[model samples]
Target chain A: MAIDPPYLLFLGDAADELAAKTARGVAHWRPDRCLGQVRLPGCKADLGLPDKTIDQGAAEGARSVVVGVANRGGVISEAWTDALERALDAGMDVAAGLHARLNDVPRLAEAAARNGRRLHDVRHPTRQFSVADGKTRPGKRLLTVGTDCSVGKMYTSLALDAELKRREVDADFRATGQTGILICGEGVSVDAVVADFISGAAEWLTPANEPDHWDVVEGQGSLFHVSFAGVSLGLLHGSQPDALVLCHEPTREHMRGLPTYGLPTLADTIARNEELARLTNPAVATVGVAVNTAAMDAGAARRYLRETEDALGLPAVDPVRDGVARLVDVLP
Target chain B: MAIDPPYLLFLGDAADELAAKTARGVAHWRPDRCLGQVRLPGCKADLGLPDKTIDQGAAEGARSVVVGVANRGGVISEAWTDALERALDAGMDVAAGLHARLNDVPRLAEAAARNGRRLHDVRHPTRQFSVADGKTRPGKRLLTVGTDCSVGKMYTSLALDAELKRREVDADFRATGQTGILICGEGVSVDAVVADFISGAAEWLTPANEPDHWDVVEGQGSLFHVSFAGVSLGLLHGSQPDALVLCHEPTREHMRGLPTYGLPTLADTIARNEELARLTNPAVATVGVAVNTAAMDAGAARRYLRETEDALGLPAVDPVRDGVARLVDVLP
Candidate 1:
């Protein structure tokens, strides 16, 4: 019998041996290619082959490829991104470790999208299909939200998680990058994969998953695409969240230089929230303000909020004080 | 004489020729070198220099520096920052046109500080400043506060000016950068330069020039040194103001990565305001929040305000609605 082609797995230096073997199993099934391992400098010990010559192995038509990476903490550097992009361009289906939170996935996806390549989720991989329900079913109440770069999204997510846990709510706050996989499955940092996993897990746990057993997945950035770009929307569409909370500040100067959606004043901000509510059709929820009190005095801030409330018909909460538990109550 | 060594004025394309010339005047005063005019690309303009030329310029002597960026929109570009850093390292004191907004200046300052250089303020040719007793002070009752960025500061300052004028108060806002020059005779950006010029003008316009007029000067940025590395305490020791209004966000998440001196909470934020009040010993004046309300409902926002007020002892005001008018009322 002709020798079966070996499977190849490409990863950062952090994958463990079992993960590599699991990847190898996926590779072993490929008919045309044999599993050939090419380990770079930083390949994780769990993934086996370390420092294998990648260039030489590729020249030999390694049928299957597996790339491994070590856990270096935080977001993958640009250098790693460039290397991964190069590997993808070379016709390798990249399986990245979902060790880092999903914060940088949108950026990576944007980069990949620019290159006309799609990143796939190695864990719970599935086909794309539209849901008949038209609304994402909320399985785990976990949610993550953040801004493009420095908009305090991670802090908000983490704080929400901490707050939820404090309230004795079985909330699982997973950062979409590093902290995500630990809470979910051993899925790579592929956003699609994560979303699929989330959706699948929600389906699997539904009815059985108590409302208190909420999975509060923290989003990486702002609502209007940017940080995780279309991921949040995609997640919302796929999962059909029960409620959406927006964290906002109410100042013209703060809103300045930002992409204007006709939301300049507190009144305008509320109007925009309504518009978002109408668009997403999710149970429109309360708005949360991460007020930087050090920046403003209490009385002045109260007056401003009062005026803003008078303008907008809904309620608002401070994420720091009221916490996520209160947010859950306020959310429809 | 040898044409006064051909004075050179470096500027971004957005600067008015008159302003450029005025900036060059400062350079002209330094007799040691031949001035070579170097024009930078404005935020909206294309970078005229080729990459090779920029590289060469960066490699050249530090004294052959360029000055004058009208806006920071393009300052973050590698080519611009690298070349500018190179020029500054080659021994040039960069005097650029900065916006009078608080948010604008700090970024510029941060960038410059990153390269171990400081942005200098160019005095406006026609502004004035003067001091008045408690009765004649512009912010006598309302403590006029200023922030650091180039754009936000200017907007706030101008808005305050408009508000005071609307209230028919004998109040005037002075740029502290300009006042610095008056006290010391030199600085960068319009505010400081204007402050300096006004200070000089105040002297020139004293009983000797116009002794009856009192001036309220506004400064840029916080007294604390905020940079990529971290926030430093006592960055604004000698440069402290009579009364200060600090801007901050109240979310713990927002404050997480930030270098703060106090606990990270709404209450902490409030306490910090009091701390600032105690530290500056300035009348714990009006507090402001540069809010963005696009994500929340107005009613909830109002409650948030009440909560914040209950937390902090001081009162808050919306800069857009009540800030300017209150400042006018507070003016002595």
Candidate 2:
């Protein structure tokens, strides 16, 4: 007899938490735009043959199936594994939002590996885009900024991107690494092959003769540690942007010990951006400061930004307030 | 014609600076007691004929030679290379206190590599060590402390060693890796083999087993950023110390960001010393706060230290005043 499409199954008493987390993930990637309606399966008892629900779904020939197994410690039970395998063998590309605790499920990991499927560790909400032509093109100008991890680089980049859009200027922000790209949604990977490709594309994209547009790139980690400095520098040398904005947290430690923090002060964020013009042999249009609102009081942060901008003769703009577009406008 | 025994040559315009740096290096390893009179070739010459000077040094039978080159931009020069090669060809292990400027000297670096000698980039006066025995036997604990390339790990280690000696303890201090035993002087390379060996040795030489003696080991860079964490943790696990002393600069950035700073405070510096500690596990015995006394007034520094101590409950000691000894004494 013919069977019907398989439905999502949420096991355990805390089904709502699992369903909520799954929804959040779905909303994060906006999967509905690409993948059609996602079905959330309630208790098997609600349907016929409660125990045979998984086998029933597999037999029915589902294209894509999303399942949630609430393993508090991330362990996939033998019964769950059997059900998952049945679905996969039935030609369903299953996606699971298993609790992180399932990381302990060696059998599930092995099963996924063997089946050519993946068990992804879901993290902060992120979006992924595919290049239209399968060609990685270099953006107009590149701006790289990084602070110690968790120093709000993503938040700042988003705020800047929003600002740029508000001002009727087009600006694209990209992350520099695989993890970064996964998080930021708009940057090129500085990995060897991609970096080389981007470097070549940059020559034509950011020609010396043309007025360069700004590309804000955020670097992760310290300049001296976990830094893709070589690759980033290679790109910078090749791209030769009109402006280079280095975002820094105005902390006493970063100031006292780090050599990078010793770079001459900017009169204002705008002037700081402009100073980059001479230092990098390009016209530094303006310097944009992305202050960590969480780290310091607003008043203190504003004062520090103002003093820095005044010293550098640059317009100081907050990523949250002015956005990336206004900041780019301030640039030469 | 009778030839004289070959000796290492040191050439520099500022003999005092070279001498001071060289002396500091020697003191770091306590070479006078371990390696005996390390020859200092006193003379400054252009050595216009680079190849000839190398040949002449080779003509003499020098076991090891040291050369001093002026700091042009914190790097070594080609002239220094000629002299170093001559010493090497003459069968001498070579060392140099070439100012930071000559560090980029390709020739010197090449010659050192070819001759299996060391080219000293004496910019960071600390982080210098000499190996008493070529082999780092099991049970030896080595602690290195430095942030960045030259954050005074060597200086502090040496100072601590000297303090240990003052207490009538026999101690051996040696540099490892690029700055110390592995690159120059005498010891096995501080690579995986050395790391493993250290781990094995630490197990037998734990403080719990030997309460009368202390084995202090340190590392440079953030515990998470470099191989330091693995090697240090291995050593700590292998050889548990009674106390772990962390030398830190209490800047707002490091304090707020580093997880190590969040370690549970020990009761005062002395009580803290009673427990074995690593960056992750070690109960902080004493914190050696390295502050720029020149930048902040002593009173201000004192206040900062007091606040840190109060908040953390671990006694904060200034390296400048309390000294390494008092800090060690406070360790349980």
Candidate 3:
């Protein structure tokens, strides 16, 4: 689902800055796509962008209004209805990554319909997909896999895409989750898709490209995650990545919500992921490792990266601290 | 998801006996659930049960009218609406596994609501599911892992459940697909579930039971099948099976729909499935092999079974030809 930009980022009455994480991500990664911020009167969050009302954003040529705030329950609150309707009336599409669909709201739906504007519920796929054919498609693809959920897969993927682009190599970051989707301006939330079509959805997201082009596909879940390994495996096969970047948050106690399962060792994670990935791409290689080192001191992070590189014989980097230049060097 | 039995089978204008495969499975496995078969004019399929109208079947204590025939495109035909309405009008619940949802049809919806009868779309899940907790629960589970889809995982599961029960062991067959749901009278079609909930749905299907009781789970897809490995992986983790019965169709040339891919070696299949299954059930073990020998002659079938057991050092049997007694004996 392509969400057109420049976007008017909605930070509707957020409780705090953290509630505007999604908006911040868009402003950080795709500033060119973001035009301005739209906040409710009592909103505590801010993206530090120019404040614009619906009419002002429309005048600025903003094509879409993104509900980028992460509300308490990922809902579209009643307080934001007026602004959303105004955006539609102003000839701007509305996109959201919320648990509640934008199109499901009666008032908003009627407004969008009246104005002939699209409502993109990015978390839910708006199109039907066939079961993955598993036929390898053309293009160089790199996928970010993790030892668990929320282990910097998206950040690593974005870094790779950015690094490859900086090197003047043709590349695209294929998002697979909500925040990633909002950041990329498009991508299917694979987890929301039917189980039968997980891989199929992945295949659709990173379709055939030039042989020299790199599709850095954002991964979802982890092969070791009990709650979501299925989504991970399907995405792995669907992406059919020629190169993989293993992502991990070293300080994580266990899989996010599954306390019973401990984090898998890096070696085990790589071996298992490569094994399953071989079903579609026999030449699939783990090019590098990206660690979330925010929990560790600078010295500790450096030592951990060095030890990881030495032990696994693969380049390791903190995507946030160190750029992904070293990681891209080993791309298959 | 349970559609209470005894069921009045509905075979509306079926093209052939093969169209009634689901009904035949139920009648063959659980004849006690079969009260009568209902046929529309021109229906070529027959379960050989006593023919009855919807009103007559309901009068005979049939609690549900199951649309047991597989129509073209798995659709709920307008031609069959009258019978379905009559079933609900007669105070019996209506159930079907079709691409078109039962409740989506206005006529059927009206009839069902007017009569206060439930409409069961077995292909779609009716209840919301939480993500798999990955915590260990009581009860032993034996899951059938296949080398490809439609290689008799359901049949193997059912056979194992039957064999276990015959030995006076407490056991239940947990279905993970549409036919399996109909066969068991209640089970989720895990493939139709949202990708995020595949494992969660599996956990719900085979929930905690007595420590000694067994839940024989019917698996879907193959770890080697690119099209469906995700579903298979999620089901494996969710099942948390103590024992696994590897099911294979020796005559298959490639991973189901994927022409370019070949099947993985049984040794690799066992190793990978066991490696992943251990995440949820650390003591998980692959106990035996179930071979579908329908494509081979009796002598060749025997030879193949013998070769499989000799190669893997696992007891191998043809579920339909021989029983799953040996497989059950090796259960942990």
Best by TM-score: 3
**lDDT per residue as tens, model 2, B1-332:** 01122333344443445533543354334333222222224533332222224444445444445443344564554444565555555555555443342335666556667766654433322332221111122232435433322344555665666687788865544443233331124322222222113333333322332334545554433222121232333333343333444555444232222333332222332232222233113433344433323345788888977886777655556656656665556544
Instruction: State the C-alpha lDDT per candidate.
Output: 0.37, 0.41, 0.91
Q: Model 2, stretches more than 4 Å misplaced? A: A1-170, A178-332, B1-11, B15-23, B27-29, B33-62, B67-70, B96-153, B165-279, B287-323
lDDT for model 2 comes to: 0.41
lDDT, candidate 3, A226-266, per-residue tens: 99999999999999989989999999997898776789999
True contacts kept of each: 0.00, 0.00, 0.92
DockQ top scorer? 3
Best by lDDT: 3
To one decimal, what is the Cα RMSD in angstroms of model 3 from the true structure?
1.3
Query: DockQ order of candidates, best first?
Result: 3, 2, 1
Instruction: Name the fnat for model 1.
Output: 0.00
Q: Model 3 over residues B1-332: C-alpha lDDT tens digits? A: 68899999888899999999998988888898899899999999988999998888988899998888988888788899988998888899988888889999999999999999999998999899999998899999999998888989988999899988999999999988888888788999989999999999999988999999999999999988888889999999999999999999998998888788888788988998999899899899999999999999999999999999999999999999998999988787
Query: Which regions of candidate 3 are displaced past 4 Å?
Result: none
**Predicted structure 3: clash tally:** 0
